[model samples]
Target: MEYLKRFLKSIGWIARGVDLLVAPLTIISGLSFRAMKFIGVKKFPINNSLFHKIGFFPIVNHYYEPQFDFKGYSQKIRHFEGIDFNAEAQLTLLHSFEYKQELDALPNVKSDGGGYFFNNGSFESGDAECYFSLIRKFKPKKIIEVGSGYSTLMAVEAIKLNRMEGEENMCTITCIEPYEMQWLSDIEVELLTQKVEDADLGLFEKLEAGDILFIDSSHIIRPEGDVLFEIFEILPRLRSGVLIHFHDIFTPLNYPEKWLKEEFRMWNEQYLLEAFLSHNAKFEVVLALSYLTIYHKQEVCDTFPVYAKDAGKTLGSFWIRRL
Candidate 1:
């Protein structure tokens, strides 16, 4: 059965290559599909595989965007229906100013004297700064970061600073990453070299009110996928007041146009989050970094003059407190 599965997979790749080689023909078929829809055809007889083969996937995506209204979703959560997301962002912005000096003091791993290094890869824009600031401010007793990397380094630095200040209840950090980096191995935090979905579910249940559940997931949801497991199982089991951080979540807007058309990053984790938060009052928005960067551009620039140049752009680091 395994050999048959592999054989089929190889054949599938060959078929995909053939489809791409005849892309012009496929695109013509896609145009026909669009015409069929225009003629009031309720549904096409073809499935997604056929759509891909006929080069209609991108067209379908462009025309029939996700029904979830991301702008309205952001607006609803930002308003004070239960928690004032804007006010929380404002408060977080204020606290961020205090941490600049300390953040600037952390030794840069790649370079010297620039504080924590940030770029397009790993942690970048204001997300790195925001994570560092939040860790210092909240002082979570325990931090369980799911997809770890540069953020782990930042969190470790924050914990170190907390200990240096002689805080009695210093936070302990743990990282769960299946594909570990060389730098990740050197970090002092407890490392679980496995997927979060496969890790013991009880690890999340142990989290109390003042902990952090940091998630930088695969961003793709499938049957029995990690994103589904975390959303359905881990989130519901966490205690109230626990801080939750989701990476690459650009709310108030859908995934970037460039990402979809150019980069082809078909990430839908934000959509899942939108669905989860729609009518549920169990969670409250704390700080939406992308939302703040776009909507509260001036404030973000003022708060971190060092990152002022990148203030106009969006960064994907969202924080929510369990209610």
Candidate 2:
């Protein structure tokens, strides 16, 4: 079955590549498809896969219309009349950077040792710095990290520092991840080798005020997916004052244009988060790395001059507090 699925996916990719090669012909084919539909044509001699391969069918073919007006939704969010949470979150992030020296003292943060390291692929662009600093600043008693990897390493280092400072309440760290990463076994965290959707919902309910729920989700919102479960099921069940971290979230702006057109990354987690926070008062933004990197460039540069020079001007970590 796996091989069959792979074969079908390969065929689909080939069709899309062929369509891109004959781009002008696909536009004409799209117009013809629309005209045929208007004349009460039920089916075409060619399969629907040919029409699906056309990139502009969602715009050109009336029958293959978009489900939502994404542009209008984005504009509405830009002009939202609610409290300026992004601005407030920027201040929170700036304050967290006061612990920069302490974060630097951690042995495993950027080390090339057997333990975890940060600022590598996927965790760079200032997100790793923000994560380590926030964990050090907040000193969350309990940290339940979903989809863990590099962030888990940061959390472990921060907790070690907290414990070293004689904070007796430095509590347990739990990581829920389906994929096998052997390094997790060496750490102090309780690793649950399963998907977040399959894990017990009670785990999230155990999180109290001042605890942390760090989520690095799949970014897709399909039915029964991890992103949907986190947004709908887990988020509502958490206690007030819980700090929630979402990685790879670029809010108050769309995902980068290059990421969309060139890389073909169709991530929609931030869009769902934007709609959820629209005039909703239960949750308040605590930190938005992308928002700060874009709008508050000077402050970020001053705070982490090395990161600014190395990673360029983009970060994807976002934080919020459950009110």
Candidate 3:
């Protein structure tokens, strides 16, 4: 019996020693996880030019601001330490990430109504600078945008400012919408070109590359969602130098309903991402205006369901050039 007691005591000591060793590692791992809660895991294959460079936290301004919920990957990244690898990750997590250059002024375009549409709000001076800068850099010959009315007006102003001329600086802008056309008296279009009924949109095949397309159709209807998906599928028709922009993402939330009465009138961002990604398009959220989303032909990912539970299919407002 005494020998058994000694054996038991030996086992207890060994167990205690093992716990002592394991505790610190376990605690360390737990702490690591907590740290990751704010940052997130470092991932490879950033997949998008906007997300590729690992520095300067893309869309970090309002992401971790604490006053509001960034939501999506940025929101998730703000909550974790490392694994939250989306654009929301701050410099603390990726101190080495590169901060890209931001454009400052419009090359040639000006807002017609005296205000630059930013974050769904009309912005002037510095606020509009970012929009102009985005226009200056993209230099799209073909422009496609989604949503309607106000956004279209703003885009018209941008196109006039950004369009460049070589032997012939030719550009075309297409806005896909189910609503009636509004007055574009603020901007000038040498030729209004042809009109495709909401049903005959299949004829967009002739747009070619270097043309821009915008999708601001309908944000509240399932058919509009389907239209967006169809447009994305036909992106191979775009010519080089194509530029596309998505409206409504200027609002923080991915859904159009989350927007205030004014914001509700615009398109949503979630659908834009889905259209781009599912069609293998590439794009970026211009820091000056996340609302001013950009796209080209590349391996983009689909993110349509990020906002609306009932979101139909992916639709986008970014530009694509046919290769």
Candidate number of the best lDDT = 1
lDDT of 2 by residue, 36-58 (tens): 66664446535355556543332
RMSD (Å) of each candidate, 1 decimal: 7.1, 5.7, 22.8
Q: With candidate 1 superimposed using the best TM-score fit, by how many Å does residue 163's alpha carbon deviate from the native?
A: 0.8
Off by over 4 Å in 2: 1-77, 86-89, 105-112, 167-169
Model 3 lDDT-worst window of ten: 296-305
Q: What tens-digit string does per-residue lDDT give for candidate 1 at 257-288?
A: 66765576668898788778776788978888
Cα TM-score of candidate 3: 0.40
- For all predicted structures, in order, the TM-scores are 0.73, 0.75, 0.40
Q: How many clashing pairs per prediction, in order?
A: 0, 0, 56
Winner of 1 and 3 under lDDT: 1
Models sorted by lDDT, best on top: 1, 2, 3
On the 0 to 100 scale, the lDDT of residue 209 in model 1 is: 82
Question: Residue 96 of candidate 3: its Cα lDDT?
Answer: 27
Cα error, candidate 1, residue 147 (Å): 0.2
Global lDDT of each candidate: 0.74, 0.74, 0.39
